[model samples]
Target: MEVVVGVDLGGTKISAALVDESGNIVADVRCHTQVEKGREFVIEQLTKTVGELFERAEGLGKRVLAIGIGSPGIIDPDSGVVVKAAVNLPQWEGISLKRIFEERFNVVAFADNDVNVMALGESLFGVAKGLKNVIFIAIGTGIGGGIVVDGKLYHGSTFTAGEIGHMTILPEGPKCACGNYGCLEALASGPSIARRAKEYIAKGVATSLSELVDDEITCEHVAKAASKGDALCRRLLEEAGRYIGVAVASLMNVLNPDCVVIGGGVAQAGEILLTPIRHEVALRAISPAPVLQSLLRENAGEIGAAALAFSKLAEKD
Candidate 1:
């Protein structure tokens, strides 16, 4: 069976896996990204991780055909270079990731944004399976999104098509890391949600979240508080959900996707967050798509990268 190496390069961690054509993970490994280190060191660590996966694949007698990487920032899929991504990792811009992997492994390599690859994985093998159109939104420290149309991942002219997080959801709300005011990420991301709860706690609103965390509250704390019927936490999450829903509603009207898949850490709030999203979409969108959760968690990027590698390999064949 043909196998490939899939790597998910995030700001915090680097996850690599050997996956078969059927999307089954044969071997997987992860380590801190050490993004504080220079680009050369991070790339070296990625190469070493891929080497380990290759060794494992060879031990299983599987022929490794290609390598695929899912990374953050504005990526040039054609060249497999990061055009610009100085937000999370310093000096990550203009990195020729494709050339590095191809020269080291002596195999075909492909790369794209992390969220885009996650959308590909879900559309092909996860919640949006067999669907030709999908919108994937990941809400964690920040929000990111990906779009798949007609069974292919859609990268806009500048390869920044799936920046759903940067969409201006509130014209005059909180400032986003992207230097935009009132972006969806600023209002509804995990940190944003936590900030809301923290603000409330500071105002002495009297909630269980303050008891859970000593210094600052997190989305997980808010989720747990909501689960325990904390009115403040529940309301905060619901408000965030409404903001997400409004953004998704706009996407639905324009893209007309069959499914919108939600994932990432904040989405663990589940029904508390999903219910409001569904409600707002139903109310605002002309024709709303089904909103679902991601099937794969940490493995989403790995599977999607493997699928991307398989796609690239097929194109060559």
Candidate 2:
């Protein structure tokens, strides 16, 4: 059997899996990123994990075909280098992941933005499977998106097409990390939601959310509070949902996708967030779509990486 290695490189862990063409995992390994140890350390960890998978695949009599990776930061798709990285991946800039892995494993390799791989995974196997046009929004520390158009991932002219989080949601509102005012990430991302909760506490809002956390407030705390029926937490998440909905509604009209999939840690809040988002989408969209949570959840990245390799290999063929 011929299999490809699909790797998901994250701030905390690097997961590598040997996946068959049908999106089935033949072998897998996970290792800590140890990001604080710097860029080379993280790369070493990735090599170790992928090496383990290679051994496992060999044991199972599977021939390794290629490697595909999904990682954070601005990637040069052609070179597979991280052009810029987010804060989570310190000093990861300019690392050529594809070059390193391909040389190490002696196989062709592919890499791209994590969310872009995620969109491909969704289209090929996950919730959005069987759909021709799909959009994937990941709401976590920040909101990122991937757009699949007409059964293919659209990389735009410069290979940076899926930046749904940067869309301006509130024209004179909060300043975003990208130095823009009121981008969707600023308004509805996990940190932004947590910040809103902190703002409420500063104003002495009567919410039990503050009592639920052990440290500085986090989106998880708010989500937990909302799950427990804390009115303030519910309202906070719902408000974020509404903002997300507004942006999604705009996407629905402009892209005309069959569905929009939401994933990431913050999306784990379930209906408290989705309810408001769905309502707002219903109210605002010229064309509405099913707003659904990711079925793949934590596995999306690894599986998505495999899907990326499959797509790229197909293009070569």
Give the alpha-carbon lDDT of every model: 0.90, 0.89
Per-residue lDDT of model 1, residues 140-217, tens digit only? 998999999988889989999989999998899999998989999999998898888888888989888767664567
RMSD of 2: 1.7
Tell me the deviation in Å of residue 307 in model 2.
Answer: 0.9
The TM-score of predicted model 2 comes to 0.94
Q: List, residue by residue over 1-317, the lDDT tens digit for candidate 2.
A: 99889999999888888989878877788887898887887888888898998899889999888899999987888899988886799687888989999989899999999999989898887988889899999999888899999877888887778899999999999999989999999999999999999888889899987575535889998999899999989999999999999999999999989999999899999999999999999999998999989877888899999988888888899
Cα RMSD to the true fold for all candidates: 1.3, 1.7
Clashes of 2: 0
Question: Worst lDDT window (10 residues) for model 1?
Answer: 208-217
